[model samples]
Target chain A: MTVLGWTRHRTNLPSGVRSLHCGDWTILVSDDPSIQTARHRLAAQVSCFDAGLDFLPTAPAQNIAIYDATSFTRTTDLDALWRKLSDRGQFSVAVRMAADQEHRTQDGRSWLKTRQAQRQRQRHCGTMLADIVAHLKLPTTQPRHTENSASCDVLVQRDDTNRVHNAMQHLARLMQGPPDMRLCVTGLWPPFGFVDLTSKTEAAE
Target chain B: MSLALEMATPQDAIRSSDTALVDVVDGLLRHGVVIRGELWLTVADVDLVFLGLDLLLASPDKMRPEGITR
Candidate 1:
């Protein structure tokens, strides 16, 4: 029996290092020297494979791209990138915040500050999503369950390629939103969460 | 040809609105398939401090091995 699970573990990560994984690609953001070495090694490994290993593959099948959000200074910059990616096909993107002074000094006060920060982050995400939806001219209805809070995850279906491109463009624009935001994007594939291993095995036979 | 878009060099837009940054962070962290792992620090090849928190976001479907499903 194949069982699939998602696990989250928290560690005392060195300041400034944040990691985002999309599909088989992993993006680590940090100024830490050791972490930088790891990132370089990973990049080399991906290049060496040429076809990208099972997890991180090369273009055509899989394309792993990196961008420094700090450099993106305009909405146009984001729009151009979005158009480029949309011209392609499947993709996914993720954004994160740099671990700064407030994150480094974890104390009682910081805990409260973190909560406030989370609220602010959610609001920002909402604004970005709203902007994207408006740009794509898609329905702006909030998912029923998450009506109160911002819906962090935006799933773009591939039924119609044009619609998919609009969704992807909107997401790309979101990545260009803020300097502190660390973003990573990847091409989409079947989700492990909903896959049935037993059914797969039976089908193969 | 790489479809990857080249992010322009830092300019006025780099300093986007605070709300924008917050939203980016929220979406990146909150939405996605998160995988957690740990890193053990070594000093002079000697294993020392253990860093227990790390997250990697990806498609949840691809991360699962055959035997583990949740």
Candidate 2:
């Protein structure tokens, strides 16, 4: 199995890697896009019954998948991307969140404050990622995929059916909460076989 | 006239920093999967701005560069 890495600009491309733009994200696969795209577009969304089975086709060898969280707006968008990656046989997926410092103003005094705030935010993100991983029962010892100064990456494998299910379900629950709470799932894709259970509560409220 | 004084406890300190909750909130704000919805202002944004300012104010002494203690 090949290990996956994540970064802003593409790096260490393997021979025969094909770049694919999935929504706002970009990825490099080993096979041709025409074949992969048609296969994924035709595959129906796998339901809970077929949850454990890997319905999507495996990605060709030495494929690199990249997703940008800055422009992510929907959980389904992420799901589709994850499904595509999974289908291509890419077991490991890295989700990256752009650092807030990029949006800082140049004023030194204010910038200092923003940087401090951003650091605090980054630390918090690290801790929360820890919690989510724990909740999803994912392994904690996965190697770091890539290094980026402006963002943090959380690496998850696709093979663990139970862990993937837990992660997806936990994310769906988080999304059901108020908007502020919903931000935690911002860069993650909901797991396969996920259903929104909070809509009824919201509607009743 | 007399006034009663309350003593601070360890619990109070933990509650003040709220390290875990703060980290979770920070993570939610900074990362995770998001659902697209119609754009609108919500109390969360207002609260987050104030929370950031509060955190900034609380650690003003730590804001300075190393070796420059206020």
Candidate 3:
């Protein structure tokens, strides 16, 4: 499984490795227009989910996470773009997993502890989302109505029921807000970023 | 006079409930279009924990725990 796309941090790509993943998900960074167009169109296919108020589930049979720079440029401003693709977001996900799960080793203890601390800070922010929702009570909308940002989207295979459900719920919660702060879920998508790394690694050979 | 909890303090006048801090935090927590392929993008979400650290460092005078920075 692989996510073919572009990244702003192409400088960080590992030697002989164009894509990267921690588990069932893989990310590919690129700035190609054709790829970006395909990604944008994919977002259009799945228009029921929202970015800020929903939680995304796991990938389907074979999932991929693609990031294209051309698409990211067409959507958001500089600050928002940088923040959207920054390692900060990815890091948060990792830390969250560690905190939510109890898998820790002595050698990885320091990293684990630091991640836990970070998770606490982020949780503070996430918990406050309730206040933001109460104050704004934003409407739920499709991507067609709003301006695009990072062309944010997710695609899951038809059989990947668990992941699809999880992604939908997660995205829904994050999409909450007032009308001015509407959440944009493009449409149903094809699994592009969700993939089992171990499975793929074994297949690559 | 003490500051209202609802409102940020004078020193943090630039800070407001409407601030993008949390949004930024959320985006870092879970934003960006993800794809899987031979060309992969490995983003360490824990790296965003730095945002909290940055927040704490910026307001050391407040002397809050990493958790309270949010």
DockQ of each: 0.04, 0.02, 0.03
Q: Pick the candidate with the highest TM-score.
A: 1
Off by over 4 Å in 3: A1-36, A40-106, A140-205, B1-70
* Residue A103 error, candidate 3, Å: 17
The digit string of per-residue lDDT tens for model 2 on B6-56 reads 122212322345432233223211212322222223375331222222212
Residues A6-79 of candidate 3: C-alpha lDDT, one tens digit per residue: 23432344322244442322334333334233223223212212121111222211123333222233332434
Q: Which should have the higher lDDT, number 1 or number 3?
A: 1
Residues forming the 10-long window of minimal summed lDDT in candidate 2 chain A: A41-50
Give the candidate number with the greatest lDDT: 1
Candidate 1 global lDDT: 0.33
Ranking by TM-score: 1, 2, 3
Q: Which regions in candidate 2 have their CA more than 4 angstroms from the true location?
A: A1-106, A141-163, A171-205, B1-70
Binned by DockQ into CAPRI classes (incorrect, acceptable, medium, high), candidate 2 is incorrect
Q: Which stretches of candidate 1 lie over 4 Å from their true place?
A: A1-93, A137-176, A191-205, B1-70
* Chain B only, TM-score of each candidate: 0.25, 0.21, 0.20
lDDT of 1 by residue, A78-190 (tens): 23333332212222233334443555546655554554465466556556545544554432223211112333323333355456555455456544656555333333321
